[model samples]
Structures are given as structure tokens and as C-alpha cells.
Target: MQKTSYLKELVIKNTHEKNGANNSKKETEKIQSLLNLFSIANPNSGTGTSIDGDFGPATEKAVKNFQKIKNAAQTGVVNQNLFDLLALPIKKAFEDPIQGSNLRELIVNTAKNHLQNNPFELIIHQQGNSGPWVRSYMDGKEGSDWLWCMGFVQTIIDQASSIQGKNFKSLMPLTYSCDTVGVKGIEKHLLTRYQAARSNPSVIKPGDIFLIQKSNLDWMHTGIVIDVNGDTIETIEGNTNSMGSSNGNAVANKIRNFKTSKIDFFSIAPLV
Candidate 1:
């Protein structure tokens, strides 16, 4: 597992790139890596900067191009302002204030906030599931082994619990395995199997968890239910995209039919 090092510091401290000032190799490397990351996400911004830990012409050019696209000054420099701009997505995801009247509302709101930030898995060092969002939800561990759908759900629950002074562990265990969550839900009398859920759609509610059941005892993916109407459930899930693959690249909002999809519901009534 690779430890995610995406802008580890909230604020860049004591570093200036340009005009031959305090451009330490370490800081320059961070700036270069961030430029590469930004370029990967925003194609028209610029090409990726080499992560050679040196503030070369390529890095400066990339910075200027990025500034051009963002409509900022094209000074080809990386000062505190540029660093903050680079770290904007992360700051928005982790530090934005959420509004909700209750715990379940809070959970849904948090998931939406994450979705708004457009969290996507970055391919770092040729490794999949590598990025700051994945690490934030997966306890700083990211890699091929970190299938983060469950991690994303648990993170939303944890955040809501923290804000409400409730214990999230009581509702869901801190594990990345959908199977573990399913089994624990069953043991806790919180799980409603697909058939049961379909027979009584009213049992499924927003803020509850929906697990994509693969077999009688195994689940493949999980997410937070944001809405339930008639026969379909709207969800905000991670590790999935518009195609709804169990293992995908980004966090997304999707709709799944409970009657057609083999999904189990885990009631959060115990916490509420």
C-alpha cells in the first residue's frame, strides 16, 4: 500500500519558487508533483511537470500555463497564492462547512460535499487507487488493494457521527470490506436482504447504507443512500463512476433500482 502524500500540508510554509529564492529540492518536488497532478485532471491546463525535485524550465512553463487557464496572472511563479490554488480541491473537501438538521441529514450532506469536490483516484507511480481522497477515507493507505467504496461510506458516517457526538462504530465497523459490513449488519440485526427490501421498499431510507450483494454472504460494493423513491435508490458512492463499476476511479452520484439490482439495505435507525 502506498501512503498518499497529496499536499500533506494545508498551507505551504517558507517556500518561494521563482526569482532565485528559497526553492529547496523538497519544496520544488512538491510543487512539481502537484503540477503534474493538476495537469492530469485538467488536460487543457498544461502538460505534466517532471517530478525531478528541481525547479527547471518545464516546471515554470507548466505553472504559467496553469495560471493562464485559471485566468490568474501568468507570472510562471509558485508563491503562497499559487500553492493555495493547487490545494483548493483538498481544502474544500476536508474543511468546508456542512449544514444538516440531523445525523442522517448530516451524512447525506457530507457525501454530497465530497461528490461536489469531484474526488477521483489518481494513478501515482503506476499504482491505481492512489490519491488524497482515497487516503483521507482509507486512513492514509492507497493502492490496488484499497477498494474504497466502503471506505467512502464509513468516512461520511464518521464525519456525521463526530459532528453529532455519536459513535459511528456502533452503526458500522471500520473496515474496507463490503462483506464485513454486510456480515456485521446481519449480526447487529441491521441488514435487510434484497428480497426483503424489495418486498417493503419503505424500509430503505436515506442515510442508510446500500450494499451491492454478490452472493448469499458476500457484497461487492457499498454507498450511502441519498434518496429512495418507488423502486429506485439514489446514492453517492466512491470507487465508481457513471458506468457503476464496483471498482471505478471516482466518487459519484448514481441511481440503482432496488427491484432489479441485488442490493441489501443496512438500517441506520439504531443510531437515530
Candidate 2:
């Protein structure tokens, strides 16, 4: 198949209907392409749909199955959320145990690349900490005043996804609030949280996001996991420093023990 860059041209707002005989061939073809890719990536996920560019019962069934797996509304119609999931890289390396490898390496490398450039030093008070690097990650939505840990993670994922012709924000919630990040993860069924005392280090993988719990109802910090060993995890965090506070001075790498009491829970974004 030729790379047509069709995803960039497709606009998703509400649910897209391609069922019955009323569907357009061009639109159905796009949907078929996505379903074909999805079927290939997730082979054991039941029967595959033919790329005939026709919205038959088989295509609708495949879409419905995908919706069920994603915990989305089983309307059998593709929506913005479903569209985003379909756009993810078929060759995921992080979460899915079946199809791919080295997914964490892609995420960690992207974060490290930003660290090497040291974009935090480019902050200016008048401009509210805006720079080429910062702006690229901000998604045209925020300035420097915003706590940027979420932005930093979002930016890194965005960069990595673009390289694969996918959209990271579409796959996960794009928010600046730590609390909201957790909520979005749960809503999207992509969040996995473990208690500090009961958590197993093996469950934590590189490229996952960890939330620092400040209280029962509040999470004060977040970072990207780069490496996970027995009871210890290394992170590349934004808006942090040597002190390890979420609102610290700059982006830096830090190591922490899984037994830390302050760590309320950690969440993993779906990359499979």
C-alpha cells in the first residue's frame, strides 16, 4: 500500500457512519484501510475485514469488536475516539505483548532528545516561557505559565507518533492537569494504577506515566518512566529538578524507589 497521508486530511468530530448501503466508497475505503491495519496488528482479535471499500456486515462487526475492546460505546460507528485508536502505530512495542517490541525505546529516546537540547533555559518572563521547543509540545494551547510536565509528555508522544504517522493526543487524553491525566486515563481505559505498598515493579514499564500522590484526592506531579528494575524506576520528568518536586526548576532525569510512600499510583498509556 502507498502512504497517502490520509489521516492528516481526515477530520473527526462526531461519530462517522459508514454502515448500510448509504456509505461512500472513498470514506469506506479509508475505514477499510484502518480496519485492515488493525486486523493485521491484532491478529487473534477475531476475523479480519476485507479491504473491498464496502461497508458490509463484516466491516461493521469488526468495528464493533474494536469498540468493545476499547471500552467505547458499542454503536458500531466510528467516532473521534475510535478513529484515534485506529490511527495508532500497528507496530507498537510497549504494551501489547503480542505484536511489537521496543515501544518504550521510542518513547524514552524522544524524551531524552528534548533533554539533550535543554529547552528549559530558553524561558523568558515576558513571553511566559515560550520557545521553539516549548511551543512544539504545548500543542498551540498553552504558554510557559502552565505546569509543563503533562505538556512535556504530550509533546514527546506527539513527536514519536508523528514519526509513525500517528497522533499521540488522539490516543490519549491531552491535558496539563495531573489529576485530569489520571481521570482521562481511566476514562479511556488506558490507565493502570497500583498502590505503593502493593505495586509490583514488573507492572511498570518504560514509557508509562507515574503520578505522585499528594493526598487522597490530589496528585501533585507526573513523569515519564524510562526504565524499570526491581523496586526502582528511572524517570525523565519536566518542570522538575534535583529536589524531585513536580514544580521544580527544570526538566531532568530522576530515580525513585517503588516503595516510596508518596507515590500514590502509576498509570500506563496504551501503546498497543
Candidate 3:
């Protein structure tokens, strides 16, 4: 999906929580959902607002609390401006400033920019992998099935390459599956198998991708290779946490030992 479409859904229509205001049901539901996303950071304002498409007292309280926390006008109202304030983090995630001279530099810098933005998957309707960030990366689809590790990587690649007027699909098919990416890498002779990477660490570079190998044919989680040192690589990966589970919640920088972990490489240097 285009950036416009990705951002378009982040909006909330009609003013809510005001007497005689046009509180459309759809807009109310959207407001409730967006408010719930804050539950991870601001528990007091983000809890127990039912997403039933109703502009009730609970939703009003949540809106006012969020406004107070943000130091905005503490009027219990929902407008486009207020919605923009609420969705600012997700909005800034897509605004890439061109800052690199090459694909590798662009990729690493783009990933770092997103890491600086601190994108987090939202917990909605008690679902883990559903949120504006997830949908933006997944091209408008988000749910349990959309494990977004590869989606996040691809989004970074797309954003960076687009700045260079290049297409990442020229390197590999745009895909959400690490296994598919691994197969493509092998077909293109671009993959450095775990043992091979361990043997010749010099082959991997910054901006390459690291795939956690489950088996010869099955690769699982993936992330951007931002920095390399000896046997360790620093990565900016999504859907992972401090524990390094592939299906984690937010984008993070992680340190991995390629010599010790069953990790493979998909080199993008050929694109340079």
C-alpha cells in the first residue's frame, strides 16, 4: 500500500464527546481502538474503554486523560487535530528524510530512524499483532497470522530504496515470510548459510538481512543488520522483544552472536 493509504486509516472522523456533536459510530469505534493502543504506556487512560462504537462516558474520560497527559487542551473532544495528535508516533514512522548515499546506508539509516521513533504493535480486542504500525508494515492487514518481523524489514527496505528510485523487488520478491526470502536468496546465490557465515564473517555487511534458521529449508525471524563486530551483529528488528522471540511486539535493536546462533544471511550488497 502507498504511504497515503497507510496514513489515511489513522484518522478519526467527526468530533466526539461533545454535546450534540456528530459522533459517528465508526469514528467512535476508531477512537476507542486508538485509545486502547495507549494502554501499554498510560495504563490509567488506556484501560476499559470498550470498543463498541459508542461515545460513552468511559470513552470521554479516556480522551480527556490522554489530552491531559499530552498537555493539550483538556476538553473531552475528538477532532481531526486531536486524532492527529494521538496518532503522531505512527505518523512520524512513515516520514523518511533522505540521509544516505547508497542502499546500504539508506537501509541502515531508515531502520535506525524507525527505531528512534520506537514503533510498537498495539494490543486491540485482546489481539497481539493488530495495530496501525502492524497494518502499515503489512500493507493494511494485521492479525495473529501477520507475524510482522519480515514485514518490518521489507517496509524499511521499501522506504529506503524508494528514495533512491530503486525497487527492492529487483533484489527479492516482496514477502512476509522469512522462509520465502531464504529460498529467494539461495536461488539468487545471495544467501550465506549459518555455517558459511560463521566461517567467513567478512561476507556479511551492514544493511544485509539476518534470518534465524530453524532448519535447512525453514527460516523464521528476520531483521536488518545495522552493525557488525567480530561474531556479533547489532540489528533493528520488529516483532521481537528483549527475549528475542520472533513474534514479539515492538521494533528494537538487538545484539546477536552469529557464531553461536543458527542465523543465515541474505546479502543485499549485490544491489549496490
Candidate 4:
């Protein structure tokens, strides 16, 4: 509990210290409360600051190492995305979920590892892309199209097991995973994250994922949860599929009506 407690404290301090040398007790407390769902994905990341609120070299290096392992940008700065990743704290109650969540984190970490340790340029699959450059050249295959989101998730699992010195059901029960691919400039799909928001306004949370099905047909398509309040849930989703939407890759996803829709796969729901 102390480590859990301390880690939360550290995040608040780190976030503040990141802003400046200035300290905000309220800000620290608030951020910790919000991020308590995340845990220390890498315990061996070395000792972080117990006080002083500074995200020092050790912590930064550790995070960079963590990011490198997750295949995320290895910038040492504790940005919003990285901070969101660390939102779930590691404790007994949250530990199992953290473990499951860590599995997700593991994916990013492994991608990071591949980028650094591998001889070839490792392109971990981002949700949507315009071309097929990397998928075609795996090991000894041409035009293989051999990449899948589940594959990306599995890479993380393999790496996580390595870190924990254990074996996990990498692909596990095949039923636990499901994914879809779509383009933005394409035709009308299911309810976009935006459509769902209008219907089930309560379900949309920041950083949460949005899944869109066929034209108003309504279904889950995208995924990623970032933050949430009473009405809207902001998220980072995949498979916008070039529908000519604004914003870079992510858009304002949500539940528009009073009801919410749930995806059938294991991606959105919590795993035991």
C-alpha cells in the first residue's frame, strides 16, 4: 500500500515539477486520485523520487526505458499520453486490473524494445495507416500483410512475460480478442464515437475508445479511453479509415444519446 500510495504521490509531484519547480498540494492530490487506477508497470524501473515532486533523471530514464519497451515515443517528458498510461495505480484491488492493463502497456513497451534492439526498423502497427510498407517485409515474406492489432497486443504480452519471468497465454483464448479496420475517406460506417456520444452521452469519457459501425446501423468500431466527465468521454481511437474527418487521427468520439453501447470483445471490458 505504501508503494502504491507513494507512487500516486510521485505522479502528482512529477506532473507539477514537470510544469515547473512550483508545487501544488491540491494538484498533486487531485492528479493522484484520478490516476490511482494505473500501477507501476515496471517495478524494476529503479527508485523514483519519494519526495521533491521532481521527475528526475532516474525516473525519466526509467520512463524512457519503459516507453522504449512499449514502443511509445521515448521522449523523457511525462506528456499527457504517458501520464494517461500511468493513470492506473498498482495495488491489491487494482492489481489484477493493473496486470490486465499492464498487458496492454506491455504491447507498447515491446514495440519500444523492437525499435531499439532490433536490426530492422520495427514499425508497430498504429490503428490506421495509408499504406502497406512494413507489413509486407516481415522476416522473409513479401506483401505478407501479416500484421494485426491482436498481434500488436500479443507482442506486448510476450514482452511482459519476459519482464515478469513467466509465461502467459500469449494469444490465449482466441475469443478474447476482436478488431476491425476502416478508412476515414470511406463510406458511412456504424455510429462513430461522436454518434454514440449523442445517444449514450454518459459513456463517453476522455481517453476512452469509440467504435463505429455502418451508416447509423450502430455498432462498436473504434477503441481507446482517455478521460471522462458527466457527459463526454474523450478518447484515442483507431480505424477512422480516412472518412475525411478533421483532427489528426483521433476525433471527438462519444455517446450522443441517453443510452450507452458496449463492445462484445475483451478490449473494452475489464478482464479478470
> Quick one: best TM-score, which candidate?
3
| Backbone Cα, N, C clashes tallied per candidate | 0, 0, 1, 69
Instruction: Give all TM-scores, in the order shown.
Output: 0.85, 0.56, 0.90, 0.27
lDDT of 1 by residue, 3-77 (tens): 123337345665555545667776675576567667767877774867666787888888888888789998777
Q: How does each model score on lDDT?
A: 0.81, 0.61, 0.83, 0.34
Model 2 lDDT per residue over 163-264, tens place: 555666566666777888777766776555557334555667777888877765478888888887767778888878798877654578899886754553
The reply for model 4, stretches above 4 Å from the true place, is 1-147, 156-162, 165-272
Q: Give stretches of model 1 more than 4 Å off.
A: 1-43, 47-56, 69-81
Q: Give the poorly placed runs of model 3, Cα more than 4 Å off.
A: 1-5, 18-21, 24-26, 39-52
Residue pairs with backbone atoms closer than 3 Å in model 3 (clashes): 239-248
TM-score of 3: 0.90
The regions of model 2 sitting more than 4 angstroms off are 1-101, 121-123, 126-132, 140-144, 194-198, 264-269
Model 3 weakest lDDT span, ten residues long? 1-10
lDDT of prediction 1: 0.81
Ranking by TM-score: 3, 1, 2, 4
The candidate 1 region of ten consecutive residues with least summed lDDT is 1-10
The lDDT ranking, best first, is 3, 1, 2, 4
Error of 4 at 28 (Å): 50
- lDDT (10s digit) by residue, model 3, range 116-141: 76677766666778767788888877
